[model samples]
Target: MRTGKPSKTAIKVSSSIVTLGTTSYGQQILPDGLVDASEKILLASGVVSEKGVRWIKSPRMVSVYRAFDWLLPGQFEALGERKAFFERQVRAGIAAGATQILVLGAGFDTLGWRLATEFPKVKFFEIDHPVTANVKAKAVSKLGRRGNLYLIAEELGKRKLPDVLATHGSWNRESRSVILAEGLLMYLPAQAVRELFGQCLAIAGAESRVVFSYIPAGPDGRLDAGRWTGLMLWLQKVAGEPWLWSIEPQNIRSFLEGIGWKIAPELEGGTGRHSTEYFAVATNQA
Candidate 1:
C-alpha cells in the first residue's frame, strides 16, 4: 500500500475500495492497490474488520452495492458514467477541433491514464492534494505509462485554478475543454461549491463543458436526505468527516443558472427512486 498522511476523510472513503473488492464488480474497476489502500484505511479507522474482507453493511451499503451492480465489474459505475459523459464531450471537442482536459480531485482515479492511452493527442491536467497526488504519481510512474500528464498539488478550494492552469501554460481559450468533478461537490460547503464553479467558469469559455456529481437535497433542502443521508452521516462520523453539505436538486439548477451556467438535463441513478444522484453538464455561456 502507498504511504502518506491521508486525511481521516480520505482514509474513510478509501475503505469503500475494500468493500468494493468484496463485490465482483468493484474488483474489475478499481486497481488492486487502491482497493487494498481503501481496505487498509477502513481497518485502521476501525470501520471494517482487520482482514478487510467484510464491510459494516447498511441501507447505504446495499444501495452502493446495487449501484456497482448496475454499472458492473467496475465497482464505480458512477465513475464510468461520468467518464462516458466526459468522453462524449471530448469527442465533441475533437469533432470541433479542440484539445485539453482538466480533472479536479483526481484522487486515485485511473481515467487520466486510460484517456491518455486512448487519445494520445490530448493533454491531461490532474489537480489534487499534495499527498494524494504524490501517491497517484508514484503509482502511474511505476506502471511505466506516460501521457502528457501533469500533476498539480494544491488545496482545491484555497488556490486559484485558473492561475495554476496559466502557470502550467496549459490554459487555452480556443480549445474545447472539459472539466470533471466527480464525487466531490457533496463534501464541500455551499459557498465553496459556488466558488469552485466560479473558478471553473473563469478558465472555461462558452464552448467549454463542466460535468460533476452531487447528492441532491431532499424536498426540504436540508441534510435529511432519507436512507442514503443517514448512511452518509454514519459513514462520515466513522470516517471523521462530519461536515457535509447538500442542496435541493432544483436549487442546484437555479444556483448554476445564477452563476451564468447553462445546465443540461440531470442524470439520475441508484436503487432508491427518491435518492437520485445527479450528473449535470454546465456550459459557461457568459
Candidate 2:
C-alpha cells in the first residue's frame, strides 16, 4: 500500500491507481491511446518490486474492486460515466477561455498531460500530496515533460489550497480557471466541503467552472448514494479513506446556489440514467 506519510495512506493512492487500471485495461473507457499510460507508469514504478502496487488489473484485485459493485451494482458503471463528464468540463473550460486548469487531488491520472498538449497555451496544475506527486513526477519525467505541467505538492489537510497556490501556483485568484475534483469531496466533512467551495469562490472569476463527483449519503451520513449500496465501512477498513459527506442530486443546485454558483448540469452514464454515483458541473456566477 503506497500511501500517506507517518501512517498508511498510500493504499488510497493505490486504490485510485486500481480504478485507472481497471478502466484503462478492462473497460476501454478511453478508446484513444495514453489512457492507460499512467497505470503503466505505476506498474513500472519501484513500488512494484516492493509490492506497493498490486491487486489491480489482475484477477484478484479486479474482483475486490468489483465486489463493491455487487453490493451496489453499476457503481463501476458510474465510474465509466465519470470519464465523459470530466472531459466535457475540460472542453468547456477551454472553450470558455480558461487560463489554467487545476486538478485537485490528482492521484496518478494523466488528464493533465493530455490536456497540456491539446491546449498548448493553458497551464495545467496537478495538485496532490508530496508522496504521490513525487512518484508521478519521476515517472512522468521519463515521458519527458509533455507541456506546461506545473506540479504543486501539498497535503490538503495541512493547508488551505489557495494559500498553497499562492506559494507554489503560477496562476492566481484573478485567473480564469477550471477546477476538477474528481473523487475528492467524499473524503471531506461537510464543513471542509463548505470551505472548499468558499475557497473556490475566493479564487474564481464569474466564468470559472468546477466539475466533481460525489457519493450521496443518507441523513445519518452513511452512504445511501443515489439508491446505491453503502460499502463505505468496507472502504474505511480496507482503503483507510471513508466517505464523510453527501447530498442528494436534486439538492446539489441549492447547495451550490447557496454558495454563489450557477447550476451547469448533472450528467449520467451512457446508459442514460445516472449511475450510483453522479457528476455535477457548477460555475461561479458571482
Candidate 3:
C-alpha cells in the first residue's frame, strides 16, 4: 500500500479487511463467512502463509472492534441488526423470484461467495472499482470454481453504471433482480446517488429490490444532529474515505417514493448507536 500508486479503492477494501477480521473474532455476528472471506483477502494481499493468516485475531483487530464501539455508541447491537436485515433481504429476494443479484460497490463483501449455494439458481455479481475488483477476483478464483458468480471490475464513470453493468455481463431489465448498495450510498454525493438510482430504475423490473445502508442526520446537513459527527468525520479522514451524504430518516420513504419505489415499512428498522445510522430496503412496483 505504501510503495505502489495509492488507490482509494484499496483503502476502502482494506477497511473491509479489518471489518471482516473483527466479525471473525467476535461471536456476535457472522464469523464463519467473514473468517473464510478474510482468508481470501489475505491470499489476495499476499499473506498466504498460515502464520500470517493468524494475524486476523491479533491486537490490531481488537483495536478495530474497540474503535467500532467508539464510533457508534451501541455499535455491536446496531451492526448485528444490520447483518440480520441484510440476510433477511437476501432470503426475501429469493422468495420473490429474483434470479440475479448485483452487489454495488461490493468492496470486500463475500456474500457472493458465501450465499452462492443457498440460491443455486441465482446469478451473483460483485461489482467494484477495477483495482479492488482485480484483487478480489484473484482471491476468489483460488476459492474453487464459481460460474454463476461473476466479479465485475469497472469504474463508475459519468453516471453510466447501467452501461457498465451491461458491458461486463447480462443486464436483464425484464428479470426480477435485487441490487444491493450496502455500505456504499453514504460515500457518494447526492447527485451521484440520484444518478445511481436512475440507472437502477431503468434496468430493474417491478419486483426488483434495492437494499442499502445510509447514515442518518438532521436538517442543515449535520450528521446525527451533531452526535459523534466530529469523531465520524475524523475517522473517515484518517481512513481516507469520507462519508459524503447523510439522509434524514423521516424523509427516506418520501425520497424513494418520488423516485418510483414502494418503500417497505420495515426498511428503516435497524442499524445505529442511538439510531445514528440505518438500513432500508425498497423496490419499484410499477
- Count of backbone clashes for each model? 3, 5, 0
Stretches > 4 Å off in candidate 1: 1-4, 7-98, 266-276
User: In model 1, which range of ten residues has the least summed lDDT?
Assistant: 266-275
Worst 10 residues of 3 by lDDT: 1-10
Candidate 1 collision pairs: 14-38, 25-73, 217-247
The best-first sequence of candidates by TM-score reads: 3, 2, 1
Q: TM-score winner among the candidates?
A: 3
The C-alpha stretches of model 3 lying farther than 4 A from their native spots are 1-28, 45-52, 157-159, 267-276
- Across 156-230, the per-residue lDDT of candidate 1 in tens digits comes to 777778878888786675667778886677767788888888888888756777777676666876665445556
Give the TM-scores of the predictions, in the order they appear: 0.71, 0.80, 0.82
Q: Between which residue pairs do clashes occur in model 2?
A: 2-10, 3-9, 3-10, 4-9, 4-10
Q: List per-prediction Cα lDDT, in the order shown.
A: 0.62, 0.67, 0.68
True-vs-predicted CA distance for residue 177, candidate 2, Å: 1.1
Candidate numbers sorted by lDDT from highest down: 3, 2, 1
